[model samples]
Target chain A: MPSSKKAKSVRAATLSDVGREAGVSAMAASAVLNGARTSSRISPETRERIEEAALRLQYRPNAAARALANRRMDTIGVATVFESRELNPYFLEVFNGILETAALHEQNTTVFDWQRGAAKLPGWCDGRIDGLILIAPTLTSEAAKVLPGHTPFVAIHANVELPNVVNIETDEERGAYEVVRFLISQGHKRILHVSGVAGLVGSDRRLRGYKRALASAHIGLDNALIIPAGFCSDDGYRAMRSWLQQHAGELLPHAVFCVSDGVATGCLEALSEVGLRVPDDISVAGFDDTLSARTTLPQLTTVRQPLRAMGNRAVEVLLDRIHRQNTGDKQLTEKSIVFPVALVTRASVGAPPAIKRVVPSRR
Target chain B: MPSSKKAKSVRAATLSDVGREAGVSAMAASAVLNGARTSSRISPETRERIEEAALRLQYRPNAAARALANRRMDTIGVATVFESRELNPYFLEVFNGILETAALHEQNTTVFDWQRGAAKLPGWCDGRIDGLILIAPTLTSEAAKVLPGHTPFVAIHANVELPNVVNIETDEERGAYEVVRFLISQGHKRILHVSGVAGLVGSDRRLRGYKRALASAHIGLDNALIIPAGFCSDDGYRAMRSWLQQHAGELLPHAVFCVSDGVATGCLEALSEVGLRVPDDISVAGFDDTLSARTTLPQLTTVRQPLRAMGNRAVEVLLDRIHRQNTGDKQLTEKSIVFPVALVTRASVGAPPAIKRVVPSRR
Candidate 1:
């Protein structure tokens, strides 16, 4: 792929070369070209000439040279176990935002699909990317021990906290609490909780939030009402359908709070099959306002995670860390940034009916 | 990214070395190790020993080396335009299938977002991948001229057929014919065709099939019922909603044939907004059995393009072409592959009700 015959000698443009051509010192040129030194300034005429010259030469700041000089690749790696699993619209939004932000900062982004187990991950420490972002990594502690300390990492929804990794996660508890509270405010006491995998951090956070809201509202936390579902729509559908069939004549919950949008979609399907209408018979709410939520007939009233914003933020942070790491300062300050979650009001959720709502089955 | 000095000598392992270590000829090794010439067999005992030796050495025949020797990278580049405009489930299915087949062949796959346009493309073709597979590339002939000729190219759902490029597509005409026939069988003579982009091949093919099917049934094609729409849900919604507004008091079509599931989803929304229930007031059918088709409350009865299968097939074929090109057999006899479509029966399409469907507007 290296097209040039003198591949080894082919070098990225340097400030020194620009200065030499512009009859100026390297530091002065660097200041004018990159606007790096806040104290330094160049006149408008000189600045225009330098910019024009750089453009004419197709001057690209060599990434490798900068890394060598500053110890910063200004690149972040996103490692994830996301190949076979459905990467719903949530991931897409966040990733899109990340790409946009990274591009804005003149930083490169590298994505790694860790279809392999975490055991093969330590090799990622070959001084390639300055920092790493693990997206929903479901790795065992033993496997996670392979992570190299040389590079800093920020994780989004890490299943298990790695000792050194800064976890950038949402306040699922507060979001869940507010959503459930909103449902109860409409006088729905028998609220069903379609929970995600029990032990995962995100899943647990949501569950805790749902329970806290119930307790705060003086509502009993019905253990039997919490159905073990998953992040996928099919999982939600199966769990709800099974519950519906098992509890044929029983009173349905006034509202259902699904762990994720995928699950919510499934829950809606199950309700439809049983001839139940959303909001009319049993109100339903979901988390993660993914594209699926909008695509649904009765658009889901769900928790907005601001995934794209987070994605863009993650890139900025990762690049900044990379830049700093290259500057010979690996300050391991334990930093955690939390973004606010908003509840999107859609057609799916409404006031609870006067009675325990019931309807006939589709088949 | 190249960490060590070993990159200079980091040539991929070859079949010859494996054969030498196993005390066999290179051809024999290729036969036994790669399992090419599958019908031919090596001795069971020798085969076992060869396999053991191959495992012991942790041998992965270097892609670049194999590519150089046989003139193939064992890699395919999938170029896609599904960035901001069309993030449909149809693309996901095909991508999954491509991944599945690429893994099976031990070939590497790289996805290029053609949304970036042709400017960034030539840089990607510097011998990294042997062949290119373009998915629904809406490139003008001027843009197509920029494609690198060194590597062979294949296309799926291409906007315009490129000279010397093999195009893989589905029999949209027949699929359209079958779906419309199904609607006709249900006594839907006044069928409305909500079509895709006006001049695109997919649109033309579907329209042809619709007209041909109606003609076959001795039914006349109603130009008034042929509505112009595009790919996205918004386009479908706007088209349908506008149609409703225009024909507020007119008798509605017996059934609506949408070009894609996304459009159908929008159609469902428009219908729901007017309080006209599907099948009860009118029936609806869609093309491309994407995930959205299943996610809808009443699962859509649509034409399945086997997008995933096509994705997988594209990878395999591209790899083969790559190998053939490398080996100096530059001839590609066939220029196209068309997969047969399937009729997925679901809840969306049903017998038309007796009542003439009409959407009542507030105005």
Candidate 2:
């Protein structure tokens, strides 16, 4: 076999090929074809000849060569951690927004898998991408300190504050507070809270909101009613199931407020397994009105975070930062951009049952 | 303000900087640092000096310069079409597998939004990616003929055959036949098929499987029972709702076999709206056991297509082709790779209701 990859087909036309066809040097051809600043010095007749040759040869500029000349790859990097070995619905919604805005700006989006606490982040600062958007990164202060200073970064729901990084966040505390208030308005005195991973900023904010809502309604906080669960469906399921088993025959809460939609799905399953119905035997509410919220049997009455809009804003903010960096502007304008959250009332939330329900014993 | 972007921080060390620090030419440093063939020409003392300077400066090679030197980008392109302005669960499962395999191979993955019938595909062959993976492309023959021959291509569930493209597919016909057979075994006589878009290979194969299963069971085909629906949830919801409205006061089918899990979720929602309980009022089955299958209220009894495994296989096959292409071997091997499918029994499918159910009139 010949040592040529394009032996069987025609190869793409390059600047040299176009230059030869136009009877000019490769530098002159590149100047005219790429619309470089030096092209203005070329005569109109010579420029027209170069342009005609390029069109005839179907010449397309190589991305690598163009990037070398302009120092812009026109690509944005998205670094995210997949939960439970899969990209959850929350990430999907946000990514859709990011992809949409990035495409509109004619920038290619490349994805990088981010392992928490991994120091491989600095390795991604090579010149392949112009900027990066971090999705819900939970970096320690030490890891945050080592972030490459040359590259501009924008984060969505960053767990810790990083120097010179803009964090896009939602008003989760208010969302949790409003949802709990809505449950209270439905005449639910005792509400169980399924909190997210302990000590995280998001989890702590939601916990504060839950306590504040109960106190405002004159319903004392029952520490026993607070169940610690992670952000996944399995966590919610295991927590609910084990709680029921340990407190068998104990009085059940009037409503269960899950930290996320995924966790709420698991809570629903655990409840159904013991022959209990949602919003009937006990009301259930979930944060983050993801697609699963509507797919449930009775549909979930949950708090809606504008995840898609926040994703779009992350790209916009990152682009602004990149532009400022390119223009040598080191001023930090906004540290955080917060979006509002709303409560969506659906079939999952109804008036408490006429009869008080007790936790069913494990079959 | 200064015009220099890196005035506030130390700039990343370049090959020239390393060479200057090591008292060697830039070309000598490049060969030693990039491990090029010419590195053996340098003496041991010079190589050691270059290595020490590189370590001291914390040098990282630029991706663009590496690609230019090797004529390989070490990046794979994933082109996919988003349905209903969002990526469905099916794409998510496959993408996760691709990302896992690609990362393991030290390749970056860039995503491009492909619009159906658009001629923008040929433009992507500008040497930015070593190979391209098309996810369920529905291209016309004319469009297929125009695919650039210089680049290697791998497609998953491509609608039409493209010359020199390796297609990764699943046994959809078998999957569909077994699910319908399972429904029949549960005592379902009148089964409704919610087919995907008309004329697509996947939808047609599934339709064939549904027909063959009915024929083997000696059941006559009912044209009215087969409702045409797209792959998205909204399509399935509208199709089911309209079918129910048109058949008001008529006997309902014993079960519904939707083309995809997303469609199944929609079917469940439409049934719930009209006060029909899944597996109790009527049975429902979905295909492509995606994440949504388990998240639904009763869960979903669907066909598992091993989407993740197929995605992993796609990357492997594409990498092999890329290697062969680089080595100047144009020989074609393995035109198609088929993966097996299985039926997953969940909470959705059950025996038909005891009483004859009739479609209720719309309120």
Scored by TM-score, the top model is 2
lDDT of 1 by residue, B1-363 (tens): 645433342222356777777887766677777656661678887777677767665555433334444434455667666565645566666766776777677555555655676776665564445577888877778888878666689899877878778888999999999999998987888888899988899989998989999999999877989999997888788888888888987888888899888898899888888887776687888899877777776778889998878988888778777766645566787888899998887887777777574657654
Task: Flag clash pairs in model 2.
Answer: none
lDDT by residue (tens digit), candidate 1, A1-363 = 644433242233467777777767766666676557642578777776677666654454433444435544455666766544564566566656665776577554555557877754554444445678887788888877878666678777677768767667788899999999889888889999999998887889899989999999999889999999889998999999988877767787899999999899999999987778888888899999887887787889999997877887777677666555545455756566678899888999988877763444444
Tens digit of per-residue lDDT, candidate 2, span A226-249: 999988888889989988888777
Clashes of 2: 0
Q: Per-residue lDDT for B177-283 in model 2, tens only? A: 99999999999989999999989999999999999999989999999999999888888888898888888888889999999888888899888888888889899
Residue B285, candidate 2: how far off, in angstroms?
A: 0.7
Q: What is the lDDT for A107 in model 2?
A: 82
User: What stretches of model 2 exceed 4 Å from their correct place?
Assistant: A1-9, A23-32, A36-49, B1-9, B23-28, B36-49
DockQ metric for all predictions: 0.13, 0.60
